[model samples]
Target: MNEQEKVKFFEEFNNGLHRLGRITLIAASLLLIAVPFMIGILNDVSPSGTGFLSGFAKVGIIYIPVAIVEFLVYAPMLGVGGSYLSFLTGNVTNMKIPCAMNARDIAETEVGTPENEIISTISVATSAIVTTLVIVVGVILLVPLQPVLQNEALLPAFNNVVPALFGALGLKYFAKSPKIACIPLLLMALLCIFVPAAINQTSLLLLPSGGLALAIGYVLFTKDKL
Candidate 1:
């Protein structure tokens, strides 16, 4: 074949591969909605108002605020979750969140337009949903295999995926204001390392201890004499 024919042939091949990739992606996306429902039926998961999924749904359905409160109370430091995933995978794709610490900070970063905001949200949510779906699908896929334990293998991968994504989102935020960012973060790490044990006896105590530590640190830092 001539050079032009060779180039044309390769271009067509590339287009075919791209089309196949899109088809697979679409199938995977559709499975996200279906798989969870299938799992519910197969497992006979119900509105027990208890157990993991049910209890979460019950709490969410009755009192949406509580879920928000819980998330806020237990939220981790900047990108640490993503960083953990990066550690696990030894891959930078773990840092795929692309969300900054908050909207205000994100707005100040390079991606500071309405279009960018949309992109940022899409990027972060895509990473999160993909990570979550991977775990669910992994567990489901392994169910028939019985003893090989593919689900166990998935846990570390998903765990690493979380922090890696978070880290990626906060990368720009980290660069913009390093010192301002590190204060609460350092305190959180210290508490995570030292106080989880003391708070383990009581779920409510954990929140208060963390809140107190954060409040104390803020106050100390704000004080002129300190």
Candidate 2:
């Protein structure tokens, strides 16, 4: 097809994707909200209006900002379909982002291009499917494997899983540009060391750390240091 035709096709594809994404997100949200109410109805018990509102407000205060930050930060990297899938499936940081980044790198696709978008979506979808299957198997095996999972010998490895995954994924990129990576890494490390609570607020820390990295990269680019 011609360039113009291809562009038109992509536009149409993205529009349809957005429409479906919105519909699914809305439906999923409604179902989530409805589940508790449905259970309350079945049990003939309901929370007080004030209690529900107060509880929701408390949780929302903590999570709402994180949700907005994640969407803003990850959407460009994940593209349309991937963002939708990742948000719906959860585990954006430890699973979807890694899968999408690995797929993009392996496919040699630049971000924001149609190729990257399709690859990201496919990778995220595959990750979601695999994660679902793993969860199902884990549930089935939970009783049988309880002793193994609860073993003190494996506790450290289980606790370090996320750090290990991110460390390995980040090492390659950090090696590529130690100059750009150093300041942000050092700043974050110091913050976590001095303010231990910051470690629990990973989503909030992403904003300043990411902004610092970008600013440093831009400066280095202008100075021809990158």
Candidate 3:
């Protein structure tokens, strides 16, 4: 009812929402990973489904119609209402949707303006151009011989390369930051290496990576003008 009460209430409410958001993100991430495997499984089982679709042309022929239908209907509605849903949910706009939503409305409604939109758009565009160039160059270079190695199946899997590459980069960035404390960061990095080694995949490394970063940060900051 009063100023302090409102502040406290809102702080608690925000904290609760943060916890819920974390849960939602965890679920969503798992679903995203699991869905690909599920689709793969379905393709394996159902001969009439995706498995039956031969070559790139066959896949494209089937995919285009369904995609066109989705784009014409469901996607437009989602694009329009997505901002409103973000506002209603009071979660940050992880991706942008051009909307009538204002700043105050968004602030009280959503957390932050969408950074993901810009970052993802730029990243995808750059990757597409670079990859296309690389593939063309590779095709030219490898045209003479070794046709078998040029096949998709023979090419190394780069899907899981992103995590290791980014992890190394992230550690480098944090290590260079003004973190005087080494214990936490060291421990976490070690854990990141070991946890995935010991247990299953999917964010087991985060426990260590996060802990180390926190420890480094704390040791560097809390020690003060010694």
lDDT of each: 0.51, 0.91, 0.49
Worst window of 10 by summed lDDT in candidate 1: 82-91
Which digits, one per residue and each the tens of the lDDT, describe model 2 over residues 1-226? 8888988899999999999999999999999989999999999999689987866766676678779999999888799999999999999998899999999999999867788999999999999999899999989988888899899999999999999998997898899989999999999999999999999987678778877988999999999999
Question: How would you order the candidates by TM-score, starting with the best?
Answer: 2, 1, 3
The root-mean-square deviation over C-alpha atoms between each candidate and the true structure, in angstroms, is 14.3, 7.3, 16.1
* lDDT of candidate 3 over 1-226, digit per residue (tens): 8778866775675566467656775776788768867886988852344444434444455456656664564333232223223323321233222222332244343333232222322333344455569889998888775766557874455455776786788677656773533555566556658676633432444444555665656665777622
lDDT of 1 at 37: 75
Question: Candidates ranked by lDDT, best first?
Answer: 2, 1, 3
Candidate 2: C-alpha lDDT: 0.91
What TM-score against the true fold does each predicted structure earn? 0.30, 0.63, 0.29
Q: In candidate 2, how many Å is residue 56 off?
A: 1.5
Q: Which one wins on lDDT? A: 2
The parts of candidate 1 lying over 4 Å away from their true place are 1-110, 145-200, 224-226
